[model samples]
Target: MFCPKCKSEYIEGYTHCKKCDVDLVDELPEEPDEYEDAPSIDPVKIRYAPNAIDAEMAMDLLRQNNIPCFSKHSESGGYMSIYMGFSVYGEDIYVDRNNAQAALDVLNDWDIVQGALGEDPDELEEPDSPEAPDEPDESYDNAPSYTRRRTAARVFAVYFAASIILASLFGALIMLLDILLD
Candidate 1:
């Protein structure tokens, strides 16, 4: 027996495909050589997802918008995954050329909205009073830029100091070894 939907062969005892839940058939019809009646549609890449999970998410979003899409991963990814249990290579999602823009639009909307969901209602706190401040703090306007510059400078200083200390220690070790050897 074989599954008509997934086109996978099954044992004689199996009546339905576990993956597709479709009834098994004794034989599958031969594939047509050419699509003489079907309209021509070119596939266009819509997004390059960083992993299979991301690709699946994008495919789901496109499906919700009535856009058909498929994912293609690097050829080596499949081979490497056998040993590593995961593949680092990203997957590319493709859709019909006519629906490419619609697929992209749907993905863009999902990107924007996905981050704003799933907030815990019980964890949220309301202000004592819902009134706007009479005057905005002028100092707060430049706080982010100033804070960012200061933080970056501090990080650079720390790394520079650490490198200098490590170099001095290495030099001292070399001198002590030279003195002992001489």
Candidate 2:
């Protein structure tokens, strides 16, 4: 058997995917039948992902949140559909017409969270921009590096100057004490 979600092969007694927790099926069902038990309303495209994998992820998120949805890949999905993936040019994710807005909201929230986590969609493609500076993702003060360096230098100079003056005063006191002793 094969899991319709993660496509992990299972021996005879397995009824569900151990990783995805979804029921096992001999094969991934085609797009139209995805909403077989959903209400009789038409399905509408709610999103277009760059590949079938992302499209399936969106479909899974929607269905997991109780929105009936499915995905249609522009290219042949083949056996890879059972693997929760496949790609050509792109794929369209659809939801029940009445659940379109709800599905959009859920997907939008996911996008927002990803953005906040700094997972730029382009970064996923290019790994890291060659021109981009190496920096931590966390935000801090916008002051320039030179400014901080200058501030630290100034503080050290002030401390050095104070130490020199203090040393001179101590030296003068020692000389005066020696004179009194003599």
Backbone clashes counted, model 2: 0
Q: In model 2, what lDDT does residue 172 have?
A: 100
On a 0 to 1 TM-score scale, where does candidate 1 land against the true structure? 0.44
TM-score per candidate? 0.44, 0.40
The local lDDT score (0 to 100) that residue 63 gets in candidate 1 is 85
Residue range 69-114, candidate 1, lDDT tens digits: 8988744565444644655555767888788667767776676565
In model 1, which range of ten residues has the least summed lDDT?
A: 125-134
Over 4 Å off, model 1:
1-34, 118-182
Each model's RMSD to truth, in Å?
Answer: 15.6, 21.9
Q: Rate the local accuracy (lDDT) of all candidates.
A: 0.70, 0.66
lDDT (tens digit, per residue) of candidate 2 on 40-118: 7686777767665677777888879999777776444433344334433366677777777787778878887777798
Deviation from native of the Cα of residue 163 in model 1, angstroms:
36
Error of 1 at 121 (Å): 21
Clashes of each: 0, 0
